[model samples]
Target: MNENKTHDLEKERQYYTNQTKELLQNLKEINEQKELTESELREQVMARIGAEKQLQAAEKALEHLEMALKMTGAQMTELQEHIMPDVHKLREYFEQCAQEAQLEANRAGIMRQAIYARK
Candidate 1:
């Protein structure tokens, strides 16, 4: 009977040891999973920050492009305004030259008539 008692106690001890080992393995797996989750979270945060920076850069570039376009429009308006007076003066000069040529031609015709009448 004493030998049987020792045999039962040994079986109980083996069962407890197996339970402890399983619990330890479960705790280790939980810790490893937590670390992996933390690492993934860190990666996601870094990626978000990088995307935000790129978005800001794109916005800044758009602003510069808009400013440049506005400047080009303003320059075009200034050039048009600056050249209008020269265009008007050129038109007037051509008109004046046409009038003077007409007057000289009429005078030459009158002089020829007088010379031919005398002859």
Candidate 2:
């Protein structure tokens, strides 16, 4: 009977050892899955940060372009104001030249008529 009890105790010990090994394996698998999940979360966070930075850069570029366009428009208006007086002066000069040319032609025609009558 003592030998039978000893044999039963040995079997119980073996069963407990096998259960411990199975539990350890299950814990290792759980830890591996957790590590993979953490890595994926980190990657997602990095991607979001990069995208936000790109959006901010685009916004800043657009602001600069708008400012430049406004400056160009203002310059065009100033140039037009400066050139208006020159355009008026040129028109006045052209009118004066036309009047002088007409007077010269009349004087030449009167001289020709006087010479022909004397002959």
Least well predicted 10-residue stretch by lDDT in candidate 1: 110-119
Q: Which digits, one per residue and each the tens of the lDDT, describe model 2 over residues 37-113? A: 55665565566456556555655655565455456665577764665455456546545654554565455456555
In model 2, the runs with Cα more than 4 Å from the true position are: 70-119
How close is each model in CA RMSD to the real structure?
A: 39.2, 39.4
List, residue by residue over 4-119, the lDDT tens digit for candidate 1.
99999999999999999999999898778666655665565566556556555655655565455456676577765665565556546545654654565565556556544544
| Model 1 stretches astray by more than 4 angstroms | 74-119
How many clashes in each structure?
Answer: 0, 0
TM-score list, all predictions: 0.53, 0.53
